[model samples]
Target: MAKVSNILFVHGAWANSSAWEKVLPLIGAAGLTGTAVSLSLTSLADDVATVKRAIALIDGPLLLVGHSYGGSVITEAGSDPKVAGLVYVAAFAPDVGESAGSLGAGGPPTRLLEVVRPDEHHFFKLTREGVDEVFAQDLTATERAMIFATQNPLAGAALGGEVTAPAWKEKPSWYLLASEDHTIHPELQKKMAARIGATTVTVEASHVAMLSQPDAVAKLIVQAAA
Candidate 1:
């Protein structure tokens, strides 16, 4: 196995780098260095660029770990030569010509979809109720509140942006499925994981599994790094 000394964490929509606060130390405890990128969430292209820039800063083999929309970012950025592997934590792994929106097109609309509200600029954010009831149900009341307050709204158009290529097509990948996720359906997660031929492990948690089950999520990241 390649020696992966660094891991870059890409957060999903409605979140910032703080989303990985609890998981970073755990990853470090496993003898690996981890950094979470705070995406602009302005556009898919921009997000991918942000990840690529982060990759350029690291010197050795690195693992890319993405959650939710961050998965889409890694799928696009993982093609870089420095990336050693990918870890998808309840995220979308879209292929070439597919956008995050298109991947979930036929699936039943989730409560999250119904609760998202767009600003005048077309950026989307989840309602507080959506955060508490759907997105992070497994988290505590205070934690959910903090998540709702600190969410970084994502541009609505980003969801429809298509990927030019998916890194998972060429790299070793692992997926940690949140079985109780209400945002991204579990079936969709299973399908994406299988499609990518990712080694998968399912956790009985909600959409924000990294926050709710950091240990389990970190464990898989360490395994991928190893």
Candidate 2:
């Protein structure tokens, strides 16, 4: 049987599968099948399970892609035997016993805290300014507005869910470092990428690099798929 050429995507906090809209077509045009999973954003376990379920549906080897907190999801879920590789786009790649929240303690701080507001529940929502200035600064006004309006509240406690085993430890990985990212901090991206020993590519974009530089993002994903 021919290889399925599957590429599965997992989005980050405050984002849904739609966030990969710009790049999915590019992957399709490259003769690859790309599917983005909609995560619950309720907790890491739920998100990881969502990714694993998606992985189970594919019959061949697949590349697992993640952005932002979605990186954490793929790092945990990418351990499946079917996962061939991992691509991280301006995302967090935590190690064993490190949660996304704990890994950043005393490291370079990000502007994410600037606009993050907590709800009555444990969820966190970014303000309009956060979307416009910190998260998707390189996007157009309409794009920024759409992101601000549609963002899902991320369960704050999800950041604290530690990883028992990091898939990056075994999987070949690629990392796209967004230089102008205020949300995750470029310095931290470099550190995580280095720690995971990923094939690193730097792009002059914001936290949402996939939106601002879809060509570059797609190129890296295609490379990882290869």
Candidate 3:
């Protein structure tokens, strides 16, 4: 296996690069340079483009770490030859022709879904109650408030966009399943991880495991990078 020289993180829907703030330093402490891409969340193509741009900036083997919708971005962009591996942290790992919306369609409705408010432009945001109670339940009150305050509204249509190529098929992959994840069901995570043939690890955390369980999340990235 080639040594992973850098790490690029992609955040999920309704989130920005700040989502990886806690995990970045930990990844650095482990002796790897880490960069978190701030996606527009307006469309999957746009997000994947941003990820590819980030990949272009780095040299040598890279580990792509994605959370939520970010996983979809990496799935599409990780095909870059510079990429060495992928680490999915409670993210949607869709296959070719499958969109995040389609993969999540059969899952049971979650509390987070009930609280999603959409703007006229079709961008979706989580209600404060939803953020506090379900999305980041394991986080501190202040952290949860920050999440709600800084969240980027994701275009609802982005979820329906399909992947042309799923990088997982060509790259070594790992998955961190948030056992208590409410936004993306744990069972769904398991199914996707199995389908992708990734080495999977389960942690007792919510959807935002990177925030509440940074150490655990960082550890998995380190393993994937190694």
Candidate 4:
């Protein structure tokens, strides 16, 4: 068995390390530490570098976990020798020369992107409607509000950052499919998981499955670590 030392989490657009707040404690309860990387949401390279920096601080083999755009981050950064496995939570998994933007286009049309509003600075933010109706429709009112308030708008360029070498090509992986996800389609999740040859678990969750189903999310990460 691979000796996984720790679990590292990467958050997607409009989210921070706090996005994994609900699941981190669960991981600790199982006697393993989990680190969440707060991406700058600047671009793919910047986000991947952020994950690499987090990986540098951790010791031993790591289970890299990602959600949404964070999936793209781990796919690139997981190529690191220290990484042992990957766990995708309602995440994107792009291949060489592919970007999350391009992959999403090839998937079914979704309402989440329709509600995204771009600013003069080129950062893309989700509208209130996006959060309440599509992005996290299954979450509680408070949870949805918190997500909307704490969103870290992603740079437009972040969507186009292409992967050079997808780590999933070399690492074992697990995928958590959010059946009720509105941000990334469930079919797309399956497609990516199949492409990466990931062990997949499906849950009736919104895009934010870690928050909505922390127990399930934590279990999958722990399984990967094991």
RMSD of 1: 0.8
Clashing pairs in 1: none
Q: lDDT: which is higher, 2 or 4?
A: 4
Candidate 3 achieves a global lDDT of 0.91
| Clash number by candidate, in order | 0, 1, 0, 0
Per-residue C-alpha lDDT of model 4 across residues 1-226, encoded as one tens digit per residue: 4857599999988999999999999999988889998899999998988899999999888899999999999999999999999999999999999999999999998897789999999999999999998888888999899999999999989999999999998899999999999889899999999999999999999999999999999999888888
Q: lDDT tens string, model 3, 1-226?
A: 5878699999998899999999999999999999988999999999999999989989788999999988999999999999989999999999989988888886666676788999999999999998988799989899989989998999987898899999999999999999998898899999999999999999999999998899999999998887
Please report how far candidate 3 places residue 91 from its true position, in Å: 0.4
Off by over 4 Å in 4: none
RMSD each, Å: 0.8, 1.7, 0.9, 0.8
TM-score of 2: 0.97
Rate residue 226 of model 2 by lDDT: 74
Q: Lowest summed-lDDT stretch of 10 residues in model 4?
A: 1-10
Residue clash pairs of candidate 2: 68-91
